[model samples]
Target: MPRRVSLPSADDLFRPTSPDGSDRSPGEAAERPAEQAVDQPADQPVHGARPAPRRPSGRVRHDEKMTVYVTSEELHDLEQARLTLRRTGLTVDRGRLVRAAIALALAGYEQDGEDSALVQRLRDA
Candidate 1:
């Protein structure tokens, strides 16, 4: 007879942090029966605002895949930009550069709406 082995599920593999942001194991801190008073900084986010930027790492884990087509000139420009960035001592792949650019554009649009550079460029095209 073969023995059975139990494996962790996806949710167990990627469990989220607790609401209070502590790394303590579950049940280590007794669950509060009532709302607890917390002293937060004046600049703390009010729930709707975007979260802070993540630390830069050479690799990013992506579960979903996307396909983007670029012209020969655009590909050349991207490679040149990659080389220029490499010369600056910050090593990053083309996908990371594209993702960072998208994040900046989205942030600008969120801040300035219609007057953002992203909006202007899209409207012009």
Candidate 2:
């Protein structure tokens, strides 16, 4: 007789992750983390007034996957950046670095609109 292996069900694999209601109030789904929501620099806009620039969900196990192909030059640059960060005592894998960079570009676009570096670059491209 062969032994069987147990595998996760579809529901288990695709569980609700965004502010899972287990510990949070219903309204918390619409709110940012307390620290982010609480501290409003006078220079910065309020969270609600403009949808708070989407921040990176750091250090969590991501279930979804996205495949991106880059040139050898780009790959070399990314590796160099990873090494530089390691030298500075910050260790993060390439995926985490890419995600952080994406978050930064999105946040810049959201906050600065047409004037953002992301938007300017896209327009230039």
Candidate 3:
């Protein structure tokens, strides 16, 4: 005859701290009820358990478009770049590519500050 062994389920493996469980270290159980945890900061008093607040739904209006002009050579290069990205299993359109490039250029400009020392010297004439 073979002896039977019980296996722990995922929920049992991740059970929350029990107030009277001997497995928990001394004085280490959560001092406040789970619901009160959010309401009271670590240094503050824990009031009676309260319901968690609902977060606002992330909905916004996107109601604007602008026209941009590009040279024939530039447009050709953008199309080639898009095709190359698709070959590499990344799907992106010309507008996304242009937006990403503009973002990178703006980040570089910001790193060199809006009123840089070179610009100041050039303007002082």
Query: What is the clash count for each candidate, in the order shown?
Result: 0, 0, 0
TM-score of 2: 0.60
Ranking by lDDT: 2, 1, 3
After TM-score superposition, the amount by which residue 46's alpha carbon in candidate 1 deviates from its true location, in angstroms, is 3.6
Expressed as tens digits, the lDDT of each residue in 58-120 for candidate 1 is: 343454568999999999999899999999998888998887777788777767889999999
**TM-scores for all predictions:** 0.57, 0.60, 0.41
User: How big is the positional error of residue 101 in model 2, measured in Å on the Cα after superposition?
Assistant: 0.3
| Predicted model with the maximum TM-score | 2
lDDT of 2 by residue, 1-125 (tens): 99999999998975655654233344564676766556555436766675656767666656578999999999999999999999999999999899999989988887888999998998898
- The list of candidate 1 runs beyond 4 A from truth reads 1-58
Q: In model 2, where do residues sit more than 4 Å from their true spots? A: 1-48
* Candidate that scores best on lDDT: 2
> Model 3 — which ten-residue stretch has the worst lDDT?
53-62
- Residue-level error in angstroms, candidate 1, position 110: 0.6
**Candidate 3 runs further than 4 Å off:** 1-62, 114-125
